[model samples]
Each structure stands twice: as structure tokens, then as C-alpha cells.
Target: MKKVNIIYWSGTGNTEAMANAIAEGAKIDEVEVSLLAVNQASADHVVNSDVLALGCPSMGQEVLEEAEMEPFVESIESVVKGKKLALFGSYGWGDGEWMRNWVERMENCGAQLIDDEGLMANNEPDDEAITNCKELGEKLAKA
Candidate 1:
């Protein structure tokens, strides 16, 4: 079975909800899924997974959470090269510039993006957003 690990740092529970929905949607009979908060997810987890999903809400200045998510993302970059990756997040401000920049960085680092723009929700995710997140998960599971 393929193994997929979802690592996320969520503030205000918005991104966390997105992560959960993605996990639910990604499940497949031949796939195993593991979901972890940034603190619990180690660099090795990212390195070992067959497919990965990362999530974090936009923080001040439209950036990832500094204390955990940013550091976690950096730590996993080299290990994630050429890996199938998906990114999802929620933003309270800006026009998703953060996600655009993140996607560029992932591409530059040799990560294959599951979606062109990735996925983003403004603040709390509604039903449509949750469904999108789940679809993202299913895609990753197939990857």
C-alpha cells in the first residue's frame, strides 16, 4: 500500500479543518494515510511518505506560521524533492499571494504540485471549500 502523510500547522482551526477533510477524501483501499500537526510531524515523516500534503494558514504579512510551519517546511524541502506534493491553506487577508509564492518555491525545489494553484480558503472554509479539500486528498492518494 502507498503511504501518504499530511502535515499541517493550523491557527484558528481553519486550516486544520481543511487538512482533516483532505485526509478523509484521500483514503483509498490501497493507500495508508497519516495526519499530523506540525509539532508531531518530523522531517523523517516527510522524507518517508510516498505522497505528502502540507497545510498552513496565512499569518502576518501573508506568510506561513513562523514558529512551526515555516521551519517545518524548510526542514523538509530537500527531502521532498521530486515528490508528489499538495498544499492547502486558509487566508484571512491578501489575494492568495502567499500561496502563489509557496507554489513557486515548491516547484523550484523540485516538488511536483498536485494542482496548479493549490487550494486556498478565506478564513473559515465553507462547504465548497471543504469539498475541494477532500478532492485534493483523493488526488494525493491516487498519486
Candidate 2:
């Protein structure tokens, strides 16, 4: 069974909701799915997982959660080479530059992103956003 690890940082629980939705959709009978916070997840987990789903809300100036997520992602950049990756997040304001730039970074590191453009929901995820997140998870699991 392939392992799917979802690691995320959520300040207001918005991103965590999205993470669970994605995890729910990605669950397959043959795969092991684990959803974890940035504090509990490590670069080794990201490197070892068959599928990696990273989620974080846009922080000040539209960047990743610096305190934890940024450092974790930085540590895994080289380890993610040729890995199947998926990204999703929640934003309170501004455009979805954070998600876009994050996707580009993953691409630059030679990771295969499941979605050409990763999913981003403004503030709390609506029904449609949740649906999209689930689909993203399913796609990542299938990959």
C-alpha cells in the first residue's frame, strides 16, 4: 500500500479543514493516509511518503507560515525530487500568489505536482472549495 502524508499549518483552522477534506478524498482502500500538523511532520516523512499534500494559509505579504512550515518545506526541497506533490491553502486576502509561487518552487525542485495550479480557497472554504479540495486529494492518491 502506498502512503499518503498530508502536512499543514493552520492559524485559524481554515487550512486544517481543507487538509482533512483533501485527506478524506485521497483515502483509498489500498493506501495509508496520515494527516499531520507541521509540528508533528518532518522532512523525512515528506520524502518517504508516496504522495505529499502540503497546505498553509497565506501569511503576511503572501508567504508560507514562516515559523514552522517554511523551515519544514525548505528542508524537504531537495528530498522531493521527482515526488508526486499536491498543494492547497486558504487565504484571507490578496490573490493566490502564494500557492502559485509555491507550486513553481516545487516544480523547480523537480517535483511532479498533481494539479498544474494548486487549490486555494479564500478565508474559510465554501462547499465548492471543499469539493475541489476533495477532488485534488483523489487525484493525488490516484497518481
Candidate 3:
């Protein structure tokens, strides 16, 4: 079975809900899923997984959450090379420039992105957005 790791950071549970949905979808494909908060996840889990799903809501000035997620993401940089990755997050404002820049950064680092990008806005995730997140999980599992 394929193993997928979902590591996420949420300030108000928005991104965490999305992470849970993604994990649920991944299970539809019979893939083993490990869903963990950013602090709880380790680089070793990322290195061993077939797919890496990262979630972090937009923070000040449209950037990743500084305290935990940023450090977590940075820690996996060396191991992310050649890994299939999917980015997801919730944004309260801005034009999703953060997600765009993040995707570019991951690609530049030699991590293969599975799709365009995964983004949901505000505190609640719409059905369409949730479905998209699920589809992202399926895609990542296949990749």
C-alpha cells in the first residue's frame, strides 16, 4: 500500500479541517495515511512517505506561519528533493500569492508538485473546495 504523510499547521483549525479531508480522501485509495500537526511531524516521516501533503494557513503579509510551519518546512528541504508534494492552505486575505510563491519554491527545490495548488479561503471550507482537496489527495496518492 502507498503511504502518504500529511503535515499541517493551523492557527484556527481551518487548515486542520482541510488536512483531515485530504487524509480521508487518501484512504479511499487504500493508501496508508499519517496526519500530523507540524510540530508532531518529523523529517523522517516525510522522507519515508510516497507523497507529502503540507498545509499552512496564510500568516502576516501573506506568508507561511512563522513559528512552527516555517521551521518544519525548512527542515524538510534537504529531504524533499525528488519527492512528490502537494501544497494546501487557508487564506483570509491577499490574492493567494503565498501559495503561488510556495509552489514555486518547492518546485525550485526539486520537489515535484502534483497539481496546480490547493487553497481554501476563510474559516469554513466550501463543498467544492473540500472536494478539490479530496481530489488532491487522490492525485497525490496516485503520484
Candidate 4:
């Protein structure tokens, strides 16, 4: 079975909700999925997975959460080359620029993003955003 690891960091729980929804959608016959918080995950999880999904909210200045998510992202940079990746997050302000920048960074690192543009939700995700996240998860699983 193909293995998928979803790692995330959420400050206000919006991103965590997205992560759970993604996990729910990733459930399939041929795939095994694991959802973990950033503190409970390590680079090895990404290295060992057939698919990796990462979630984090857009923090100050439209950047990734610096405390844990940023460091975790940096840790996976070298290993993510050629890996299938999916990114999703929630934002309170701005035009989802953080997700765009993250997608670009992953692409530059050679990771194959399931969606060229990562998914984003403003504040708490509405029904549509959750559906989109699930779709992104399905794509990640199939990739």
C-alpha cells in the first residue's frame, strides 16, 4: 500500500480543521494515511512517505508559522526533491500570497506539487474550502 503522511501546524485551529478534512478524503483502498501535528512529526516521515501533505496558516507578513512549521519546512527542503506534495492552509488577511510563495518554494526545491497553486482558506474554511482540500488530498493520494 502507498503511504501518505500529513503534517501540520495550526495556531487558531482553522488549519487543523483543513488537515483533518484532508485526512478524511485521503482514505482509500490502496492508501494508508497518517495525520500528525508538526511537533510530533519529523523529516523521516516525509522521506518515508509515498505522498506528503503539509498544512499551516499564513502568519505575520503572510509568511508560514515561524515557530514550528517554518523550521519543519526547511528541514524537508532537500528531501522533498521529486516527492509528491500537497499544501493547504488558512489565512486571516492578504491574498493567499503565503500559499503561492510556498508552492513556488517547493517547486524550486523540485517537489511535485499536486496543485501548482496550493489551497487556501480565508479565516475558518467554509464548505467549499473543505471540499477543495479534500479534492487536493485525493489528488495527493492518486499522485
- What residue pairs clash in candidate 3, if any at all? none
| Candidate 4 lDDT, 1-143, residue by residue in tens | 99999999999899999999899888988999999999999999999999999999989898999989999999999999999998889998699989999999999999988887888889999999999888877877788
lDDT ranking, high to low: 2, 4, 1, 3
Across residues 22-129, which tens digit of lDDT does each residue of candidate 2 receive? 999989888889999999998889878999999999997889999999999999998999999899899986889998899999999999998878889999999999
Which lDDT values do the candidates have, in the order given? Answer: 0.90, 0.92, 0.86, 0.92
**Per-prediction TM-score, please?**
0.97, 0.97, 0.94, 0.97
RMSD of each candidate relative to the true structure: 0.8, 0.8, 1.3, 0.8
**Reference-based lDDT, residue 99, model 1:** 94
lDDT (Cα, tens digit) per residue for candidate 3, span 5-112: 999999888899899888887886568899999898889989999999999988988889999989888888888999989999998757888899899888888998
Candidate 4 residue pairs that clash = none
Which stretches of candidate 1 lie above 4 Å from their native place? none
Q: How close is candidate 2 to the true structure, as a TM-score?
A: 0.97
Q: For candidate 1, write residues 42-118 as lDDT tens digits.
A: 99888889999999888879788899999889887788789999988999868998899899999998998989697
The TM-score of predicted model 3 comes to 0.94
